[model samples]
Target: MLAAIRSIIFIPVFYGGSTPIIILAFLVALFSESGTHFMGRLWSRYHYLCARLILGIRVKIEGEIRNEPLLYVFKHESMFETIDLLRIFKKPVVIAKKELLVIPLWGWIAKRHGLLGIDRDGGGAAMRQIIKQARKAVAQGRPIIIFAEGSRAHHGQRPELQTGFAGIYKLMELPLVPVALDSGLVAPRDTFVQKSGVITYAVQDEIEPGLGRDDIRDRVHAAINALND
Candidate 1:
């Protein structure tokens, strides 16, 4: 199929050609953080172009992406968003799995850039570390982003939020911004071939902080699936 062919060609160009850029990024991280920041932005933009041009995938963003130090929860269904980080926020402190912190030079760069790691299995220690990181991020005026579901779900699947999200929410007490999108239609999880489609990201209105646990959870759960269909 055309989709399969496109995927085959794109894999090498995007991934292969990106190697040098990432290495330069790593070298730049050795000296200047700003250089690394520029590299990160460049890498993300590269992926974006691949999705748009090679894969024929288009992203339609709805709603405003306000500038504020708030907790932003995005629906997780595919890894597409991982490469689209810069596109989502000007500067977002994304809370991702602690395991990712072990990825060689990349992890070092992420830690240096202040990304919070979540050790889902490390229990109390993990939570404590993430909370500390989150607090620091908020104080720095950087917005926090997390995939509330913890892991990618099947397309059209709506999963309950991981417990860690609620704890972080309550403790940080920042306003919540839930984002939903349908990137799976074009770039699905666990596969490389992509079908051309319009991926929509619907950002919902901000929810005030200090709501009851159940109330906030239910509200965000609904909002994060606004475009799941």
Candidate 2:
């Protein structure tokens, strides 16, 4: 019953509060590019606030977040970490699936802020586009965030990463940071129910660039799944 009540209140408060921010963000994106970035942080903070105050969810980050321009490969568990990650990094350029770029007005704002759109099924053309955007983002000192698996997995399920991760890693030629989180235990995939619990985001060791594809893949896979083990 408590969970139900929280859901009822949270759904409205979260969306209702965000509607204005979204509008203002889009409007701000018109005059200055930084406005969208500012609103994005606000949007994430609002969600975090709702999760903590209404749903009783607490977030804890373990290990230091390195301040280097590099690629960030995160565990794909749920949307909780997805939004929270925006707040974690400074001016990150997220590589999101192509569909997200077509979401009406939100997509336009995302593009304005330099988020790269990924065409998962576009074969070679897609990879070339991703690499080009990633290279540009890195040169501009923005960290790139991508999910190794390319999609969300249920808690305790370790899925094989999509093949594109290697292509991006080799093409970008930057240090890699693997982020591990157990958010599915609280805000799970494809579910409306949110449980009250603490979610830990651990940043593992940074892997140097210029490694073989197999070696990089193996190290990142193990690092991200370490929390599960």
Candidate 3:
């Protein structure tokens, strides 16, 4: 009860105070890519802090992330996992839905931070765009992180893996790191209420770049299920 109350009260104050700061941070991110990376890191630090202060939830990470220009296929459980990645990796180039880029200030900030937006309905063309943008990001020496499921999963169920990732794996021909997150549904979806709990992130084995697309997807799915079990 106390936790719920604290979370409820903290929402308004937290967002009210953080909005301006986020805008200022976004502006700083727009001018320079390096600055965007730095600000992204800074935003993640503050985001964790705010989550703790408001919801009493903590984040824990397991496994080591390899330092190389590669692709990270992560499980999309909730928005938390997305924010958490800012702290886990360096200068990550995220693949997100294009709709998010339409959001007012937040979308603008995401664009500045080097996020790659995809039109889910663009079919094969979307994959081509991803490959084009991903090549550029990888060339800059940043690991590209894609939520292979493409969107958040339903409560108590694993999300269906999307096939677009296969194109990325085949085109980029870089190492693919499988990432899994546990307990992200604590916050649920379409609601601001947060349930107090610990969310765990695990980085599993690297799938060598040469593997067939199906092989890579199978490996990543198995890794994610291991976490669920």
Candidate 4:
């Protein structure tokens, strides 16, 4: 019952409260991309507050966030991390599927903020385009965030990574950081009730560049699921 009440309050505030900020973001995008990013980060923080204060959920970090420009491969467990990571990083350029960039207002703002949209099924040519965009983003000192599984998985289920990860890693030639989190147990995918507990982000050590694709993949897959183990 308490969760239900909080959900009622959170639903309106989460989506409705951002109406004005989103509009401002749209206008600000015409002038500066940084303005939209600032607004987006503010919104992410607001959501975090709602999760803590309203839903009785807290976030606890267990590892250090690196300062170097590297590729961040995260475990996709819930929608919570999507917004949460935005606030966690400084100007992160997320590599999202092409379909997401076709959304109305949100997609427009994402494009303006320099997010990379890749055609997941477009074969080698698509991978090349993704590498180019990622390189550009890295050149500008923005960390690139990608989902190893390419989509959210069940709380305890670890799926194989999408083919693009290896391609991107090989082409970009940057250090990779595997981030693991237990978000599905709290704000689960395709659900409304958010349980009261601390969601933890366990940042594994950075995998240095120059490793073979199979070696890197094996280590990242293991490191990211370490928390689950």
- Model 3 reaches what TM-score against the true structure? 0.91
Which lDDT tens digits does candidate 3 get at residues 1-229?
Answer: 7767876786777677667778777778657778877877777777778888778778777888864688888887788778878877778889988998999888888877778898888998887887898788888898888888877774456666787877778888988888877755576656666788888778788788878867877888878756776
- For model 4, the superposed segments whose C-alpha errors exceed 4 Å read none
The lDDT of model 3 is 0.78
Clashing residue pairs, backbone N/CA/C < 3 A, model 4: none
Ranking by lDDT: 2, 4, 1, 3
What ranges in model 2 sit over 4 Å off?
none
List candidate 1 segments past 4 Å from native: none
Writing each residue's lDDT as its tens digit, candidate 2 over 54-143 gives 999999989877546789999989888878876777688888788888998889988888788888899989899889877887787888
Q: Point out the worst 10-residue segment of candidate 1 by lDDT.
A: 83-92
TM-scores for all candidates: the values are 0.95, 0.96, 0.91, 0.96
RMSD to truth, every model:
1.4, 1.2, 1.9, 1.2
Specify the poorest-scoring 10-residue window by lDDT in model 3: 183-192
Write the residue-wise lDDT of candidate 4 on 1-229 in tens digits: 7777887788887888778877888899889978988988887898898888888888888888754579999998988998887788878888988898898898899888767889888999988888888788888888989987989987888888887788788888898999999999888888787778889999999888888878888898898887788
Model 1 lDDT tens row, 131-207? 88788878978889999999998778999999878888988889999999888778888887888889888899999
Q: What lDDT score is found at residue 116 in candidate 3?
A: 86
Is 2 or 4 the stronger prediction by lDDT? 2
